[model samples]
Target chain A: MYKVKVYVTLRESVLDPQGKAVQQSLSSLGYQGVEDVRIGKYMELQFDDSVTDVEGTVKEVCEKLLSNPVIEDYRYEIEESAKQ
Target chain B: MKFAVIVFPGSNCDVDMYHAVKDELGEQVDLVWHDADNLDQYDGILLPGGFSYGDYLRSGAIAHMSKVMAAVKKAAEAGKPVLGVCNGFQILLESGLLPGAMLRNKNLKFLCRTVELSVVNNETMFTSLYEKGEKINIPIAHGEGNYYCDEETLAKLQANNQIAFTYASDVNGSLSDIAGITNEKGNVLGMMPHPERAVDNLLGSADGLKLFQSIVKHWRDSHVVKA
Candidate 1:
């Protein structure tokens, strides 16, 4: 079995409103010198080891379904399961 | 003409869309489930606003993969008018039928209010009834309606006159103040506003009625016998 860990974030060119809001809240809470905070998403997927080209398949899935290329970017790490 | 208002599991605007088309526009309109196998009988397709799949993965993300989306895509390729509003707009973008994607509102709030929209391109079937630069009142309700596209795509849209509407005032902090845009062929339109909700004067705005009229007008004009 393969365990895929994916991270997705809004592109730098696109505004991160939710992240910005959180940054403001942090400032109000007495944090100092906080430069900026950009929020993102993390996803995990499990696939059977019978699958080949695991990396390539994950890449295609990320581009097609896991992320919006127009506004977000994504990268994934695949790890083999000890059980399988 | 017949219209199909696609109803996803969590779609909230399908009924409003149906009312606008059947009672207000005086046309045949039906609510089609997202699992339907075909859409060939419809003259136009409408994807209404609401949280489909409870907006699980992303706005319009999960719904784009629904069974009926393929039929909707085919309808678009067949040159039938396809309109996506609010969540519908997000679906169109997620499906890649329209360029650009949506981000959270700049204020990070769920905004639901009426705003004025200026018709940037009145030549398209969706806006032909309105004069260029004409402002219409429409209600926008969504949390993620900030539209974003690359500079190159923006240049192409401007060159093609594909931008259909711009908010007279920046209501959602959308790039270029864009509220609605059409595909290269102008048959597919995706916007953040709810025109169906504005069709009745009882709701305090009938300005959006012209948009429905424009669609009917264009369809009729194209179906006419050539001289």
Candidate 2:
């Protein structure tokens, strides 16, 4: 069995309005030292032991659906589970 | 010409599209479900606006994977005209039928209003009825209408004359003020503005009606023989 975690974020070159708005709110709340804040998505998936290539499967899902390559970048971490 | 208005879950503008083609343009039209895999019968395909799949994951992201998208892609490859407006445009971008992806509006607000758009390239089948550089009023309603693309893609789009319409003034902070663009072949168009919603004078501006007329005109010119 395997557990995978994926993080998808807007590319640095792409502007993130939501993140900027949050940053402004933080500044208003007196967090003057915060220079930047970028928003992103995190997803978790569980796979059964039958799945052989966890890394390949996670990459395929991220590239094909979870994140759009045109404006977003994605990275994933996979961990093997103890047999039940 | 027969047209198909693809209806994905949460698509709210399909009826407007259907009405524009059927009643306003006097053409045959039907509302097609997103799960259908065939789109060979339609001369033109319309993907309307609305939060598809509840805008989950991202606007148009989930909807792009629907079964109907394969048919949409097939129709586009077949050289049939495919028009996607607002969320529909987002779907086209997500599906890779168009070059750019949409970002949240620069102002971070859901904007809904009519704006002036300049016809950048009138030679394409979708804008042939309008004069070059003509300004038209179209209503736009979306939060993620800010279009983004790499510099190389922008240059290519410019060189190929694939840019169809640009906002007269910056409305969404889109790159190069691009309001609409067509595929390299000029057969598929994805735009933030809702032309279907402006097809009648009662809808505040009939400027959008000519777009549908232009599509029909092109189809007739190519497929119908004048005896």
Local distance difference test, per candidate? 0.93, 0.94
Q: Model 2, range B100-148, lDDT digits (tens) per residue? A: 8999899988999999999999999999999999999999999999999
Listed per prediction, chain B TM-scores read 0.98, 0.99
* Model 2 chain B poorest 10 in a row by lDDT: B194-203
Q: Which ten residues in a row have the lowest lDDT in candidate 1 chain B?
A: B218-227
Q: Once superposed on the true structure, which residue ranges of model 2 sit more than 4 Å away at CA?
A: none
Query: Candidate 1 on B161-213: residue-level lDDT in tens?
Result: 99999999888789899999999999999999999999988998998889999
DockQ of all models, two decimals each: 0.87, 0.91
Once superposed on the true structure, which residue ranges of model 1 sit more than 4 Å away at CA? Answer: none
Residue pairs of candidate 1 with colliding backbone atoms: none
> Model 2 lDDT vs. the true structure?
0.94
Task: Indicate which candidate wins on DockQ.
Answer: 2
Question: Could you give the CAPRI-style class of model 1?
Answer: high
DockQ, candidate no. 1: 0.87
